[model samples]
Target: MTAPDLEQRADHIVEQIDRFVADGKRVVLSSSFQTQSLPLLHLVSRSRGVTVYFLDTGYHFPETLEFRDQVTEQLGLDVVSLHSATTKAAQVGPHGHLLFAEDPDYCCYLNKTAPMETVAAASDIWISGVRRDQSETRRQLDEFVVRSDGTTRYHPMLDWTEPMIADYQERHDLPRHPLDDRGYVSIGCAPCTRNIPGSDRGGRWFGMEKTECGLHVDLVR
Candidate 1:
């Protein structure tokens, strides 16, 4: 689809969100403070009724945490910092050894899936920034979907492309993620993500046949 078509769909989704709030719905934006993720955060922050939540995975790059604080204060966001239920004793040291190599999915569950599930328990509408052009897995996603886990999901930017995102960021004078210019178009936990050159590998967890961090995939099934 063209950029205009994508923008129209995004506007439509935002309008629906506005209406949902007017009708007393509990709306939340599950943001990661990614460069592209900021636009939706800004959108939700404009309304007092829409809440924003993010997981503070212990493994996040220091820069991500800094940016999260900066954006939250700048936008006057009532952001909830979701934490992993597993204690430091269970996650670290020699005994557990989760996500050292083949157990990336397990690690994702603790850091991404679980924390989000906890925060979303009380929310009816959960907004996401997933876009179609980001990956083949994302291409199959619709603008609005109901997950198996029960939270209503909205992907306002589902059909948007990288160029479209760049334009929007530039127009709004938005800050880019620190890693965006360093060959990493998608950013997640520092260890699970890497730099990809050219127009390839748009998804995080690339080169491993894993397109998601267990958050989206767990919901699909």
Candidate 2:
């Protein structure tokens, strides 16, 4: 889509978010604080008391945590950091060490998906910064979708391309994720993430066939 087309789509999503809030629906925006996240965060923060959920997998890069703090403070966001039930020590004690290396899927299930499931139960709607151009798996996603549990997900930037995102961020003067300059296009946990140029998700789960970290997969399934 053209830049203007993407802008219009973003406006529509903000309108939908406003409508949902006005109608008294509980809504939460899930963000990874990646390169594309700030625009969505800025859009939702326009409405008061909208919770922005960030998954704290404990394995995240220090730069990601710092970026999260910066954006939350800069936007005055109503942010909630979700974490796994098991502590890093507890997880490693029983499961051996580096669960992500041994079983990335299950590691993600325990760290990311489980916490989000709790958030999903408490909220009527979930908003995310997922874009179609990011990956082949994401290309099938719709602008609006209803999950099996009845929570509606809104992908405001589903049609947005990298240029569109860059345009929006530059227009708003949004801060880029620190890792972005270091070639980390898609930042996840530190162990599984790498620096891969020219591919949005090539940096994620580098050599594995794993595309998603179970959160999106479990939600859509």
Say which candidate scores most in TM-score: 2
- The regions of model 2 sitting more than 4 angstroms off are 1-7, 93-95, 219-221
Question: In candidate 1, what are the lDDT values of residues 1-221, reduced to their tens digit?
Answer: 56576567557666888898998878888888988787777667666787787888777788888888889888898888888898745765345565635567777787778888876776788888887777677777776777656778877777667777777667667777777777766678777777776644454566676668866664442
Q: What lDDT does each candidate get?
A: 0.74, 0.84
Which RMSD does model 2 reach against the true structure? Answer: 1.9
- In candidate 1, stretches whose alpha carbon ends up further than 4 angstroms from where it belongs are 1-11, 92-102, 148-150, 199-203, 218-221
Error of 1 at 116 (Å): 1.1
Q: Which candidate is the best by lDDT?
A: 2
